[model samples]
Target: MVNIQKLRFFDCNCSVGRVAYPHLSDIPDVEGLLKEMGRAGIEEAMVYHTVARYGHPPAGNALLTEAIKNNPRLHPVWVLLPHHTGEMPHPGRLLPEMEKHHVGAARLYPGANYHNFSLSEWCSGELLGALEEAHIPLIVDMDTVSWEDVYKILDNHKQLPVITATCTYRNNRYIYPLLEKYDNLFVELSRFMGAGTIEDMVERFGSHHLLFGTNMPQYTGTAAVSLLTYSAIDRTAKQAIAGENLGNLLKEAWK
Candidate 1:
């Protein structure tokens, strides 16, 4: 068996604060999050606040910055809202603050229904244009954005990069078409449990499109790492999924 404890991994998806799931115990705070990362050999993670996904964006984004600003290991992902309603800062104003706080990416929570404005599957030309210019990629989960909406967004902004989280084995049919069409679309392998799916994705698409993300605190951080470690792909591909792919993406997003 591979010594998973010794392998350094980077988790692209993580969250802090309270989740409504009553069954989860020992929810990690900032310090506890670091400890959990240490135990799992996770070198770093891109995290969002649990509040950000379902609560007010400005408040949640502020809290996320406060929680992770001093730590490089925990890169914060800001939650965004439609600018027309003035619920959140426009991308013009937000990108500067994001740079100041060292945030690497942004997310949208369409399902939270906190506001009446819609994401239009990210098809808002004004919003998508702003993000494309800012160079920050969009992150979403199945609960937040639907596949049909995501398709609409991609159709309009082919150059805009997006990473979808909480994706699972059953999403293959939809994922394949997106992967085939958009070079900028990425999928996290954390919850993907389709048997032999990872190897197949690697074979069909290059390793660059597959990223490592553990829906941590809900799922064990080691779960994705273990799944990748024991997969049939070569070591380079495994390492890419572990950290390299995300590292390159982050570097490019800010450039």
Candidate 2:
């Protein structure tokens, strides 16, 4: 058995600050978040702010930058929106700010509950096109958007690295086809709890596209860590899913 500690975990799905409905394990500050990461043996995390999701993107994105200013381990994943309404920056300006802040990844909340926006080519083509051009990794939750929309985004932006997180377990039907189709598409591994699911994915889709993510605050890292630790795959595959895959994605972004 490989020691869990040896796997350098880099969480792709995590958030900080108090939300409207706070989770029982929610950590509202960076100190507590860092401590939790240490407890779970997580070396780094791509974190966003609650305000960014539920509140305005500009203010929330700025708050995220300030909150995680000096912490290299806690990478900021800024919440972005359509540039049509002037609520957020256009691609030309947004890329520079991302570079300045050293943001590792970007996310979109194009749902009724959060930012109400369209993900179609006509609506988000400019922004999505820029992200693809820059090689920035875009993270989207499956619950927030329909599978059809996900397909459209992938089909349109072929080279854009997109990570789909927080999908329900029934997602195999919808997700499997996507994994098979899009080389730029990836899935976050926190919720794939079916026995031998990870092993099957590694065998079929290759381990490079499956990322390790702990839906922190709402969940703990222990289960996620164990999921990869005890998976019926080789050590090299486990390590790649744990952090290397995400690290490579971040490295490819225009820093």
Candidate 3:
């Protein structure tokens, strides 16, 4: 049996504040979020504000920055949009803001139901290029973007580290090919609950690209942590998926 405590999980997909559509378990404040993390033995988390997704990115980003200012364990993730619409600052201004606020990652909501923007090169090439050049990890949810768009983004920006968050077992076929092709691609473990799926992926592609995430407080951290606890992979690989891989990605962004 694996020792869960030794893994030191660092969640990569989390949010703070009341979402526009919130589950009963959603955590709306920093204190509650910290408490929940403590209960799950999660040492750190990269989080974005609900407002950043449901409201305005700048306001939500600012709110998240302030909320996590005193807490080193909670790193802020800023929601980004294509700058052409002027909904967000251009990449030049945005990148500096990220550095100033110590934001660790950037997220995109390009679905027709949400941000209503295209991820095509013609729309977001400048911002994508800047993120690629800076080595900042770009996170997108499979629900928020189509597999075709995901492929296009990965194909266009080979060096950009792109993490697909909230992935499910249904995504295996799509995710597998991407993993096989893109070394910079990563998968966040939240809703990725397929029996023996973790073991299978590790066996096939290795554990370096599998990241620990809870999707909290929309879901529980226990499920994701349990996946690692019972996984057949060796200790070192478990440790990497639990936290080391995410730490290394953030370190690269800071560099």
Off by over 4 Å in 3: 1-5
Predicted structure 1, TM vs. truth: 0.92
Model 2, global lDDT: 0.88
lDDT of 3: 0.88
* Candidates 1 and 2, the one with greater TM-score: 2
Candidate 2 residue runs with Cα over 4 Å from true position: 1-5
Model 2 — TM-score against the truth?
0.96
Per-residue CA lDDT of model 3 for 1-60, tens digit only, reads 884346888899998989767667657998888888877878899999988888888889
Q: Each candidate's lDDT (Cα)? A: 0.80, 0.88, 0.88
- Report the lDDT tens digits of candidate 2 across residue range 25-62: 65788888888788888999999988998888888888
Model 1, global lDDT:
0.80
Residue 244 CA displacement from its true place in model 3, Å: 0.3
Residue pairs in steric clash, candidate 2? none
lDDT of 1 at 7: 46
lDDT of 1 by residue, 14-44 (tens): 8877766534676747776777777777899
Q: List the residue pairs that clash in candidate 1.
A: none
